[model samples]
Target: MSSEIAKYVSECFIKPKYEVQEAKQPYYLAPMDLGMLFAHYIQQGLLFAKPSNLGDEQFSIHKLLQSLKDSLSLTLVHFYPLAGQLTSLMDEAGQKCLVYVDCNKGPGARFIHATLDMTISDILLPTDVPEVVQSFFDHEGAVNYDGHYMSLLTIKVTELLDGVFIGCSMNHALGDGTSYWHFWNVWSEIHRAKAGESVPVSRMPIHNRWFPDGYGPAIYLPLIQPDDFISLQEKPDQLRVRIFHFSSDSIAKLKAKANEEHNHNNTSSEISSFQALSALYWRSIIRALNLAHDQVTNCRLTTNNRHRLNPPLPQEYFGNCIGALKTTTTVGELLEHNLGWAASLLHQSVTNYGDKVVRDFIHRWLHSPAVFKLDVLTDCYSVMMGSSPRFDMYGNEFGLGKAVAVRRGYANKFVGKVTSYPGVEGGGSVDLEICLPPHSMEALESDEDFMNVVSLPLKG
Candidate 1:
């Protein structure tokens, strides 16, 4: 590990307090069609809470770990699939393919107790992505479950000088961002509630996988061969990740500019804040990279299909219900057009995903022979944006207090990929976590148009 990472993980060990398995029966899970595509990737996030709110009397490392372990066991009773492992099986046709979660696996999610010698400020105030924050998660190599199908979740609780960091690593195949947060929220609720106090039914998870009437497990079987694991394209050796904060005012300015241009062109379409900012980031990144004018660049935006589906899936549905909305155009067209033009294209792409379109997408996936592939940035010019600012990142309060700030793990390292989170300061601000080549990032930092909308880093 790098020295920067070593500084945060001063000491770490698995807590043996709640190591026993709690599930009584094996709950087999053949994930939704969309879930099968995400089986290989892991999604992680770090929640940091300041020490002031959780002093020794109210919260100590020992008490926190015990609470987490105990609450996790109860949480898993409801979310039993999490305590299981993802395994591959042969289908009825004797085809060597089918990835499903076997809930019979022993033991539970890995819970680790760690100590960090630094304060929360030292970790989040850094201009660049902090290695310390990344160290909170288990390395990909540590848990090889795709083949053997081991644990689906891992929790690391690290004690800091001025706060506590709760790190979670969840198998993306079992759930998407919605499912991930739903589990955390329930765990928090259970942890904070008094003993014997019932957790609200609304906070519980719904795990029934939904599909078309005739479609069944066979349609969701794994298509990629054992040796054909999907991996991201090669990124620059010297890539950098940084968080750019866009306050409500800045976002408003961007929206106004985009709408003004749309009206000037006599177009009936109006752009949303998400589209405007996404357009701004798309244009800014391409300009910073200085790609060829004729380069065929693409902007891929992830849209949640829960509401778009006909007879929409339950809000608590616990798997991937996401679709990608892509806009393809030459770098010349992107650069030559005003912000409104790009925003219009994005808005149209998102709006086009009605009930019929979503159903058609599901139909196409069910019929395709090839495994579904997550669209990663394949080159310097291709961009993919994910995560929404609407997610309640700061609302998780696990008895200690609400998280002061939240940071995603190293999963966002793919070149040209960006993830957005609700700003720690709240008030309708958005934090854009961007990854790009080092040189491109330097240019983006200096770009007048990009810098104008991004808030300056806060000073103590």
Candidate 2:
């Protein structure tokens, strides 16, 4: 182990404190859920500044771990699917294969306690993300296919000198970013509940997984074993990660500028803050790469399917409900036009993903089940967005202190991949964590058109 990640002690499984009522139901993996079978576990962290009242016993490392474990046990009673392991079985034909969570005799969540020599600034202030931040998470190189025997969810609490990081590795096959944060929010609420309270989780997860009416509930695949279908995503040594923060002011200006032209020229749907920001990023990154203007590129905009389905799944739907709504355009067209032109493409794509479009996607996928691979997602000319700026990042407080920053672990990352988070300042602000090659990173830092709105030299 490196000096930065010093101690690894106390490893155990945290099962539910009481038997769950819904445990009897067969947990289904829908087509959308299984589409991510090859992706890495979603690894992310919440960094908390040490409380001023450090002398109190409640602030001790032992106290924090005990509380986290206890509340997590309570949380798992309701979110028990997370405590299960992925299992594969042959079809009736004995030719095809399928995978589902084994909740009956499953092992619970894996929890690890560790210490680090670094401080909070070691992560947040760096222009280039430090290598040590990768160690804070579990299942560093593990993909979702490994969940067959591996724990579906792993939480590691790394205590630092002046801060602490709670990192979680969640099987991507089980949930999307929405479900991941939903679990985090519930766990935090339980941890923060009063001593005499019953379970305080306000947003209870609904464990009934969904699929198009006639199609799924259990989607079959072409492989016999996960190994046959899985392709490991190797870390790209050329890519460097950088975080660019945009204040609420900058976001509003971008939105106004994009919407101004849209409102002037056309009477379609208005450009959203997210669409406007995505346009800026897509254009800037494409410009930095200096790709041939005529070259074709794409922006894969991550959309939550919960609200887009015909009947619409409730927010509490407890499994994967996400799809990448893609927009393709030639580099020449994207750069030739103004911001409004690019923003409109994104706006149309987002607003156009209603019932018919969503169902068409589902129907098409049912006919051919291929998990998302790394090729189209990592091209230097292409850009993909993950995580949402609307996620309640700072609202979860686990009785210690409010989270100051949200950071991600080293998994499923490649050049041109970006993750967005609600900026700490709130009020429509956003932080974009962009990973690019060293040359592109340097070019982006100096690109005046884009840099003008970005908050430079991110403070820890």
TM-score of each: 0.89, 0.95
Question: How many residue pairs in model 1 have overlapping backbones?
Answer: 0
Q: Enumerate residue pairs that collide in model 2.
A: none
- Lowest lDDT 10-residue stretch of candidate 2: 224-233
Off by over 4 Å in 1: 6-40, 52-59, 92-94, 139-147, 196-198, 218-225, 230-236, 374-378, 457-460
Name the best candidate (by TM-score): 2
lDDT of 2 by residue, 17-120 (tens): 88876776667798888888878899988999877574554467887888899988888888898888887878888877878888755668999998887778
Question: What are the per-residue Cα lDDT tens digits for candidate 1 across 421-445?
Answer: 8877778889899998888999999
| lDDT per model vs. reference | 0.71, 0.83
- What shift in Å separates residue 338 of candidate 2 from its native position after superposition? 1.4
**What overall lDDT, based on C-alpha atoms, would model 2 receive against the true structure?**
0.83
